[model samples]
Target: MSHGLSIGDLAARTGLAVSAIRFYETHDIIKPVRNAGGHRRYGRSDIRRLSFVMAAQKLGFSLSEIAPHLHRLPDHKAPTKADWTRISTKFRKDIDARIDALEELRDKLDGCIGCGCLSLKSCALYNPGDMKAAEGAGPRNLTAITT
Candidate 1:
């Protein structure tokens, strides 16, 4: 049987600030038991949950998005390898989409810089003929290249 831990023990184990752990509890990402004196009591699974939360945050997930996934993990059972794989697949797809968008923006900026066109309407890099500029769909100015 796993031993129950105090909030301070959980914080020490996870290397997270006590307040951050408390914040996660408040956000419903974790639920610790209340002791007789009302101090929070955590369990072994809290370690795994908080680890997942920190990892998700490092990958740029918002607290709201991470909360649901953390909550879905079985409380009494550790997450299966398949569960992690599934979650990673979704995160990978999101990362790929962001990379593709960034690459496209880089290419467009390169084209704009190469052509040295200053006018937004006349510049192929900015205009794209579909009137993306008129619709105000992209970067407002060519200054991005310099900065």
Candidate 2:
């Protein structure tokens, strides 16, 4: 009934549930116009926006992190390949940091196990006597990683 795509059309095109599409709208990740009948009408650009969100989530990004980048792009304009490339480049540093943090955790866990600290009275990770409490709370070795 209009130039915009229907909610169902968008769901079918993106392989997303209608409710998920609505949810994205609520989060400002996808913007839809209301038709004369008050039904949600999305643009072709919305598909690309949602697809980017999907890819970003798969890469371990929270909606919060992806939202700012999406906000920078035009809502009604379809992003070019180069546009996506430029937006995605910023994530590399975050990905690298996560990888490094995970590696550090693995190494620390290995060290703890190799030292037979798992069931010992003097455990580094288990903190059997609150020994690492002096260094502060929660996963002493991985304290460098944050939200």
Candidate 3:
């Protein structure tokens, strides 16, 4: 019996479906080894890796965004607490920026619905005769966070 977890064990530990584990594998988020029997075998670290992936996805991070951080982790063995702390520090900054953006959008959302109603003075605060059209499409004021 070679030392390593089966794909099923990985999924069970992470509460992810077998298919979902495979999808993560394809993205190189979790690199499993093949045992002598040619079956997939995962390291214990994979549980934490998949758990991190699940949490990041819940926070609206794309696989592309999450991949780089995970890729930096050692593939053959468990990562140290320092390794996780370093990655988490980076993520903390990103999370803070996202929180700021969401707060800005929340605070300003009521001012302009971008429904082409320029009558309200609040509309002037944001769109101002659709000047945002020249800047680019989409909710310009909401996205920019100018105030």
TM-score of each: 0.69, 0.77, 0.88
10 residues in a row with least lDDT, candidate 2: 110-119
Best by TM-score: 3
Clash pairs (backbone) in predicted model 3: none
Misplaced by over 4 Å in model 2 are 113-130, 145-147
lDDT string, candidate 1, 32-115, tens digits: 777778877787877988998898788777898777766666664567888778777877877786666666667666455323
lDDT of 2 by residue, 1-147 (tens): 247999998999999998999888989988887878887889988988988888889878999999888887876768777777778688877878888887877776644322223465437445655555566655564674543
Q: lDDT tens digits, residues 1-147, model 3?
A: 248999888878999999999999999998888887889999988888999989999999898999999999998789999999999999998898889989888887778855456778888876678776776666776656533
RMSD of each: 5.6, 3.8, 2.5
Error of 1 at 64 (Å): 1.6
Candidate 1 segments whose C-alpha is farther than 4 A from its true place: 105-125, 128-131, 137-147
Q: Give the per-residue Cα lDDT of candidate 1 at 27.
A: 87
Q: State each model's CA lDDT, in order.
A: 0.71, 0.77, 0.84
